[model samples]
Target: MAASTQRRGRRIMMAPEELDTFLREARTCRVATVSADGTPHVGALWFVWDGTSLWLYSITRSKRWAQLRRDPRISVVVDDGEDYGELRGVELSGTVEFVGEAPRTGEPCPELDVPERLFPAKNFGLDDMPHDGRHAWMRLTPTAIASWDFRKLGGL
Candidate 1:
């Protein structure tokens, strides 16, 4: 699908590359899902932006997982900055698919270690994460996305 864009003064819209960078640099994203009864569930998750899609490692037993099993649609938001002038973010909506096996609680598993490998290197400058197990990967291929950078408004 084509990238979504909204006009804001004279600044150019955030291109696809810019959106990838934004998702990569941000440490955490808020994932939103809906329950069978239509109640909204939102939670913070550590994610990896692998150029084409968002990969999330989650505990299989979590409520979010249960909700996603019933409904695969999800919305994710990743953003940063303390003040309004510095605010910037990306919002993505898509359907997610479960990938690979879920590491059972107290079991040893290596496939679900993207966080162990990528999170530390990208966020903490470390070689590896010091933990493991009880998690699974969820892949979201965004169908629609929107992003904004307050810095783009400086010229106005």
Candidate 2:
């Protein structure tokens, strides 16, 4: 992921360590994709952050998947907190690259090892990943990342 050179809200930005922790713990993210006709679609998905990249396991037949196949550009937001002052989130935007196979079925791809381990452990508390033939991997190493922790404002 490319570093954010955000100039407007430096005070509210999460430090690198804080961002990593947040992404690791967060459960669901909203993925935004554009169709060939320029229609925008957003859907919630389970993901894993491997310190450097975000991995999305998506159903190959889904709308989001179809749209991404047409156009790889995507934006993802992982956020938490109910109140204004408590809000914090990360926005990652870039193109996604399909990893492994379409509708992965436990292929021996060394590239998937880390995320395969991390995803189940974080989301399902499992020692190993269970592969459903419907889902496959997409990796987004963001071109730009912007994060904010409103909690850092100290109730202002």
Candidate 3:
């Protein structure tokens, strides 16, 4: 059997349940922003989808935080590891807002000892790594949403 590579430009969808599932299953998303010189910047961030909205936290001193402070416009990507027909992901473009500091629930994890942050931290390493004193929280509001899943059911 020949494999077909189905393609579409904007497969954006906004169903409450589908969004929730995507958030639950995916761990990391690539965040894109613009620098002062109009160049594009991208970084991988751990994020959590809280039902109606997506919540992400960043430290105060990072360059991404500094750039985002000036420009709130951002693009986010969430996906899996599969190739070709088995690919799945969600791309989001939205307005960003800088909130207060990222808090720690209790004692920090041992991974916090590693300054490089090479280990997993989140429920499935799909979210941010909480450290001793990272910057703060940056929230993205979805002005537009696009999702793709080669699965047959398509989140039904």
- RMSD in Å for all candidates: 3.5, 0.9, 9.3
Model 1 Cα lDDT, one tens digit per residue, 1-156: 344455452253466688778887887999999999999999999888767778887888899999998999999999887777677788888899887666534234464465456766886788865435677778888887877777676743
Whole-model lDDT, model 1: 0.77
- Lowest summed lDDT across 10 adjacent residues in model 1 is found at 1-10
C-alpha RMSD in Å of predicted model 2 compared with the true structure: 0.9
Q: Point out the higher-scoring one by TM-score: 2 or 3.
A: 2
lDDT leaderboard ranking: 2, 1, 3
Q: After best superposition, candidate 2 residue 64: deviation in angstroms?
A: 0.5
Select the stronger candidate by TM-score from 1 and 3.
1
Alpha carbon lDDT at 101, candidate 1: 63
lDDT of 2 by residue, 1-156 (tens): 476576778999988999999999998999999988888999999999999999999999999999999899999999999999999999999999999988999989999999999999988999999999999999999988899999999996
The TM-score of candidate 2 is: 0.97
Candidate 3 lDDT tens digits, 18-137: 656877656688989899999999999777665444556665677787788899888899887455556667777777765443443324544233321322343534245445665455
Per TM-score, what order, best first?
2, 1, 3
Return the clash pairs for model 2, or none.
none
Best by lDDT: 2
